[model samples]
Target: MAILIPFGLKMQAQNNTSGNKILVVYFSHTKNTKEIATQIQQLTGADLFELVPSRDYTTDYQALIEQAKKEINADYKPPLKNNLQGIDQYDVIFVGSPNWWNTFAPPVATFLTSHDFSGKTIVPFITHEGSRMGRSEADMKKLCPKATFLKGLPIRGSSVKEAKPLVERWLREIGVMK
Candidate 1:
């Protein structure tokens, strides 16, 4: 008999061990961040968790922009559908999100505040059209003040599939891979 795993729970794990537990947590609006997160998980052998919002965003681009802008201006934190269990088990965390209005999506912020990241290493990655990393790193630092922040990677959302080499280079630069 074969065991079937649900798609959401199928986190990738490799045999490589660096003596540090790692987790890749991300919020993908258009699957761009999700793609990057998957690549990071494969490279670092980290567990993966997706940030799902209690309320869904619109699929329409213009509408999303309006909603995001409103939320950002209001400093809103949307409730999350699930919380990261066993968060203390990880020593290094890769937080990924799609850049929205020069910052991370509100759901990502919600996730960041929901955990205690003291002494953990936070490596940020963002997907953007032209804004690059935006204020994501700074914003995350504020939320996770006790966590060590590493240099971030920003990829063009449209070209996420070609981001493997870039991601690999970033992992080495951040000292996550030797």
Candidate 2:
């Protein structure tokens, strides 16, 4: 005999919670940052949005870094694929990205600059090889001047799955979960 469960209920059971309205926006180059975002979504039940670059970066790591440096140096704001509607509906905005050249990824910069996050609780999470949050925390402060910036979680890209404890701690810090 086979037992069947409602698909919707199964999905709902896998999510963290629906009590809190949260949004998770992230920029991932080689899927490192995306892994972190997925974990946060699991822990917070936040709606997820990918912060994609209008132009894909070069495949060569060093070339990509150099190109990213140029964009950051120029303070460029590349266009995003989609914009979050009803952003004000979310009580918390969890932004994620891979640290590039000691700062948040350029596409994430574009997303933050383009949106008005005033009065929102802005939480940042970053994955990096070694820099660890670097200048991202301060940079987010400047970008979302009107939003409440919470202390963020920084995890090594290679250790993303192992960061569940830290992510839960951060969620608790923000009062998202017990």
Q: TM-score winner among the candidates?
A: 1
lDDT of 2 by residue, 31-95 (tens): 88888887777766567788767677788988998988998899887887666666777767888
Model 2: runs farther than 4 Å from truth? 1-19
User: In candidate 1, what are the lDDT values of residues 1-178, reduced to their tens digit?
Assistant: 1112233223333422456878888999899999999888878777788889988899999999999999988989998877777789789889999999999999998989888999999999999999999999999999999999989999999999999999988888777776
Weakest lDDT window of 10 consecutive positions for candidate 2: 1-10
Error of 1 at 28 (Å): 0.3
lDDT winner = 1
lDDT computed for candidate 2: 0.79
Overall lDDT per candidate, in order of appearance? 0.85, 0.79
TM-score of each: 0.91, 0.87
TM-score of 2: 0.87
